[model samples]
Target: MIGKARGQEGREGAAGVLPAHGMTHYPAAFYHMTHLFYQSGPPLYAGNICTGRSGTAIISLMGETQGRVLLVTSGKELLMEMTPSMSGRGMELVCVPTLKYAADRLAAGDCPTLVVDFGWLPPSERGALLELHKQFPKTQLFTLESVASMAPAVPSPLRRLSWPLPMGFADQVRVIAKPVIILADQVLFSTGAVQNAFQQAGVQAESLEFGAELPDFIRRQSEARAASARTQKPKKGWSLLGGDEEPEQEAAAAIGNLVVAQFTGSAAQAGALDAAVRAVAPEAVCYLVSGVDTQRYAMQSLKEGQPVALPREQAGRIAGIMAESAEGGETRLKQRERERILLLDNFKPALTALSQALIGHGYEVTSSMDGAEALRLTTKGSFHLAVVGTAITMAELSGAELAQKMRERDPDMRIIFMVDQYPLKAALQGVSQVVELGLDDAILKPVEASRLIFSVEKALERRFLLLENARLLKETQEQKNQLELVNGFQKKFFATVAHDVKSPLTAILGYAEVLTGKLKAMPSEGRYAANIQTSAKTLNVLISDLVDLAAMESGKLRVEIGTLNLLAVMNDVYERVKIAATNRKLNMTLEVPPVLPPLAGDDARVGQVVQNLCTNAIQYTKEGGKITIKAELKPDRVEVSVIDTGIGISKEDLPRVWERFFQTKEAMGMRKAGFGLGLKIAREIVQRHGGEMGIESELGVGSRFFFHIPLNGPPPTEGAAGAAPAAAPKPAPPSGLPPAPRPPQQPQPPPQNPHLPPQPPQRK
Candidate 1:
């Protein structure tokens, strides 16, 4: 039954017989007997090969006949079974699971030429294959689907009379040859979907199911094969694939205090290195000497203080050498030495005198009689300090205004304010103005030389102190930044994970909601759906709380300040939470005076504060408990309180109740579900709105939490803790309970009124 199918013979066979195995029980006879090879010798090919694709196996069998077989399939067990069978038939077999692995081997310029692609792969693997194909265009792509629809034309030399194929081979196994009709035995299944996919991918597939079609398919796969060998220029020499023999040379100028020296054919390089050290810094000067004489010369110079020397033995100790040098001690100071000083005054003589005084102190002074000229000079140069007169006769800017401009230019700049005379009462005004302008000091005019010198020296000293402090502060800030980076990463990770988890939970909740309505007639299913919705909501709440906490801690929370109607805010909260309160059989009430004034805060955030407090009350309270929300217009502020008869806080626990994640014993006892962040977030919001939030409670009684915001309403300004326009902060009830009873000072001796019998127990 085994047969060889050549050009004419394959055509007749394609039209002839069908096997009785339903094309499933493929005999091994066709694998050996089918002679369908091209005459171009060993050709390049690549594609996915797996059990599901019949053409891939056929292509693999063809490759085995002429050369080695490289199987690309993830099914290792399947390959293991096929390996021994293929080996017994005297063929070589190699298997790679992923397209990437196979492509990599091919790109190394040394791998098998044939690749058989079978079925759909992941996009990434397919992309790797496509990229490799671009690199080696001679490499052929053979698909099981593309080959099954054609009757392959087996060349004369490639055709055999009779060869026994290994077990489990079938010529009837179907393949999807794109847009071609071979005989029923060789026809492909599911050609439409595969062809459409190939079209979308811009792949031009050649059919190989017919004998007449073999030449064209081979032509496409071998388009560049003949040209590739003729075009390749031979490599010139043996390349060092590891690396270059010589290392890369670093730029000589980039070498800091440390210096590198190389001795060229001589033992005496010390003289040359000494000259080099003089060109840079004397305090540094490390020598890397191969000869003992050069090292001795360097050590002798160091001993005589002519120059410093670094040891060749200590060549590895770069950090230690840097530490020993003065260069390390004054790195920051050297950076700050290019200091400029600005002097401004209408009196040119005084200005010149003061300028000379500072210049004598080694300061570079830029002088100007006109305030406008001084500002222009500052613009032209960077200044470390400024000396400004109290008054100047300039068209553009006044002296104080000029100082303000300088401060704006560099907030760290030291400024000294000078005046003509220090009037007794007026001196305070001048001093306040000087402080407000951020000037270092204000000296009266006709200033004595000693006084001016003293003041200037003090200012410079203060400036140096500030600079040193700033340097230290920068180091501290770097450490702080590292910690903040870690915290930021953690926060972002939590936020991202929470967000990702929330998406699926949202879908689940949505589905459950839909199911709840649909399953109303089935109580059991409806109950399950309700549970799902409730669980999803609880998870959503936890995620929301975590996100809000992160936002608050990272300073990302924002509130828009405006005049808010307290009554409306309270009423809105009541309406939102009344149902929950009623469900617990708790009495909830809202009290707002009709003539209350508007408070200053973000309306939405203020509403959140109220809602949180009310919700907390509802959660904590028992049946028949009462909750009251009250808002009133105080003399300078609007006060809002949420009072509840609940499991009251203990004395020790009262202070810590606002701390995040600090759940109380009562809450834990009730097994309430919460993140314990509401009060903390509420307090932060209130503080951000320029308000004070507090609490009062007595154990076993009740708790009242309240916040007060200014009615005149000056919310905190951006980047500053500007106080609200309210009166000075007055201490509210200092404790959560009424003030403890004071001990009688002297016991009052039964009221030094022993005579009046305590006034008959106080007349009514």
Candidate 2:
């Protein structure tokens, strides 16, 4: 059974057995026990254990110690087995089972060391350890893992140690041949452990408690080494003919090879150190030896493939990693240097400065102060990307126009625009236009080297992505087939629905007419029946139009040509639409030459076209508007026009009126009842008769729609009319008769008897 010590008596008894070490003061029992567990291994003592008010077993030792150390693990037995070995050594061990408890212990006070057992931790919970370390960087951190063999040779900071420590642990943790510098607290350096560790690892190590002097020290060392190397160079051998002169040696690199830094809980200090290292050695491999937390110095380490933070225990791997990184960094630099960039700016100073900055970053840069010269350069040599100023001064081609021409030359090249900040709205609009035009990106000037580099990288990345997508789409034949199938199915579905509704709609119209007649004596009921009949007729026309649209889309629309009597077709249409016009209080008229030449066309379709025009005019026209259907004889054909005093179409909208499903804004506002397919269908019919259709209109001023059909009928090539054309030559209009004059006003025609069948109008 484990014994417990509590209160002052327990604290006194535990303190009596502790040995003194010249370090920070801490509770005696914990200080002794932690050292015993770390140094002597396993359970050696258990009698000094004490329980706190919170029910956790804490061993309190009062003595001078290095600092308090927190051990977090899930293995309760390990703590129980090791509790008895708490007598000497200046360290404290507080064991907790989870990270939450570890955080709680940390919140209590200053703890300078923490050890985590990874065997019991989950991968998902590993990030919490980094957070804990970030919160408490003063802690000397370590980890114990059971599966160290499975870790990568160049392990990340979180996976630095293994349980059942690997062979030659001290040797494995050595820094090999590279020099190491340790920046830590003064007390840490005084302990001698950090220095001894580096010494035994066979590396020259220096310690600096203050971070400010590191950069100057490095710079001085570099200068001295450079001076020494220069002095050591052999003098060129002389011959009378200069044949024995030695080849000049290659210059030493300006950047250092590798640097390892230990962060002492100061972000500004760490950043300064990083900047200094970069100034002296841009390609140097920097290793940040952080505790369990790495978030502290993340921002300070900006360059890719430069600094990777590692656990303090992995200091030995730095030298090996440095050699590998150096080789890999050179390869990457070469690849970057191969990327050719074209810079175009009419402003000479800006162009020169930007060119130099890009070239310094290892890009091959070609710059031009004139837009035309820049274009010529692009033709002469290939470039991976172009950086252009939006305002190109003293040039015939603007930046935007130049970009378009360049794209025409090579579609794959990536482009980025540099825009000025003045004229704020225009700059914003320019940025938007860059995206709209599918150019890569836009950067607001004055451009910083860092920002420009970042933009260039991202644009190139997008270019590659688009190219890959285009290649994939080309190879996906199955997707194309599926798209075509979907379109075909949609057309078929619309046609099927239209056909199914036609039968029911015919019955509805017939029934409504019957109801109207039966309920005539009842005025209200008769009105309802009439309304139903009217609605049914509108629906029938819409359905017929939909059916015709489907047929035309599928290329199945056909015209059965026969002898067409212009007078009879016009009169039939006039009678059919006269009731609708009268209901709306609109005046309608039809005028045709008294003697007209016989034409070859489909009579029913022709009447349908004329009726569609009359219906549209009625729908848009205000009350008491006028509509005229006029036909005149021409030398080769007859011209028929539908003139309306309804709302007129704007000139811009007139061209689009013939397009299917397109409605003018005014037309839609006045009547929301159409699919806008009537005009499209009517025009298609006219074209199928080997004729052309056109419209003239003015907003709010009425419109005139017309078509011309040959008198000899459609040409022989137009699939021969059902009958021969009448042998009569074209007849002239009545002498001294004005064309399309309105008749004198007279009494309104009486409504047709509801029970009487309607009769077709006779030809003039």
Candidate 3:
């Protein structure tokens, strides 16, 4: 019974014992019991319990975790001291002495946590640490310092932990559960502590200690996976088309497990390892561990952040935190999905680095190393924004010059400039230049990825706003054009209706006049006939005004130019309106120079203009008021005025007298028979004859309405002679009025060809 109890105690000890530094120094009895457990018992490690030594049925216990922690330090003594504490808490420690080795490890897969001992890192490598997060964004970075030199006022991404780790401080380390293949020096694997720890954590472990053998091993694995995939038969119904021949297949290489390697001191050998892994098994996860002497290096600089410390006792808690963080973690900077960016630079290294940084942040980036090539790309492709390097040296175009050319192609394209710090004059001018060139922003040299991203987002937002505004403006213009088109169509419809009504109206007026003559013997019947004739004539005048207004609106009013006798036109107008004036109890007179200069004008249209002015004067003048029609010859034109003692227009209403359908309150109360289009139509006719009309009036006294006819007549296009002038028809006398006698005139000259220009007046 005593021996059996002792055996049970040994088994329990082996099962619960933590793997740590100097773990090889166990009692002989403990080793014997461990051997026994390994040979014939339930698998002690987390690796394949069913497949045993073959490790074929490997299952990852930590597959839920996405990435691992990378420890970078050159302090061998510190590492040796921390190894035991880390191992005691079941944490996995992989240290790389240099930044290059750290990069290799991170590039292999995702890294959620990074711990760097800044105090022990070489001075030459300190600056590179500032940009480490850009290259590996998934990492949650921390730095160890010997002194608190950085100000707490400035915020930084790095979590700073003081050196000479505190007694109770702790840090989290990621656990690897998948099968691991280690490539390192033979001394590292000699003790088998790493293998044992991995096995305990359910991670299958193997080793190839020589760096020279990695390429061959990778090549063999790739060939074996390819052969296995190719040998497999296709499943039934794999091809959409039924055929005897096999369908084309893509041979997918199998990535079996993770790899942990320690590279040699030679950089070339390390580069070879990276190339071999990428070429043969691109999907394989790898960790490159390197070592250096901390005694030779010194810390020369510090970075900004809040100071913290990790304690040994709380190591287990830190591990749990790391596991939680890695499960589903986000980077410090937010990702911008699917926004295309054009990056221009002449320096290859800077261009490549920035390109990677932007790509990691979820931006679709197109980079150009030459300015000319960048311009070509910009012309061919559409981009939301462009980041230009102002100090370009490789191509014919500088950064600003290239941006200007791009702006010419796309006026609304958003641009940001990356300017150098040297040349103080240029740097100082950058702000004004940004505003002048309409650039979005200008960032100094060595711009941080975060700041650049913020600027880019702002620029893109502005671009979106501008595009939206332009779209709205275009829509408004389209609506305005549509409204104008509708108005034009309505005017054309009015003209057509007015023209159609004139033919029927003329017949009504002619029949009414005849009826009046026939019913002269009966007083009552004659009165009715006269009323019908008067109403028809008023309707005819309104229709004529409507037609003229529509024609003027549509730019179709016609005036046939000819040599005019001013005396004949004035006499015609006087004869037509004098009887109406006498009936209204207003005295009308006409005064003109008998031998006035021959004017180039349309005789009938000019007669109509004079007649309209006289009619308005007669209608608006009070009883016993005087109306005088006067004509005077000026140096370049003839002035015709109608002076009346009438209810005149107010100053406020004078300017609006020529507007169609506009009427004053006094005019509406005095007469509701007209549509207020007469003055507007008359003014248009006078203008078409190369003339202008205006009115001078006072509210209570009198009004003088006048117009000017240029001696040259209307422009050639407006008043070109199309046909001979039609003779003016005589009006029937009104009821109970004598016939208007014609004024005697001198013998008229022979008519000239209608198409010929007006001849000079003959001096008699």
Say which candidate scores most in lDDT: 2
Model 2 spans with C-alpha error above 4 angstroms: 1-133, 136-358, 361-489, 716-764
Instruction: Indicate the TM-score of model 1.
Output: 0.31
Q: In angstroms, how far off is 351's CA in candidate 1?
A: 68
lDDT, candidate 2, 611-690, per-residue tens: 88888888988998999989887656688999999899997887799888899889889884778899999987776665
Error of 1 at 560 (Å): 3.4
Rank the models by TM-score, top first.
2, 3, 1
Q: Write the per-residue lDDT of candidate 3 for residues 678-705, one digit (tens) a residue.
A: 8888887777665678788997787999
Best by TM-score: 2
Report residue 153 deviation for candidate 2 (angstroms): 36
lDDT of 1 by residue, 255-314 (tens): 111111222222123334333333333222222222122223333332332322232222
TM-score of model 2 (CA atoms): 0.42
Q: After superposition, how far is residue 716 of candidate 3 from its true place, in Å?
A: 4.3
Model 3, C-alpha of 457: deviation from truth (Å): 16
> Local error of candidate 1 at 244, Å?
99
lDDT of 1 at 703: 91
Full-model lDDT for every candidate:
0.53, 0.61, 0.59
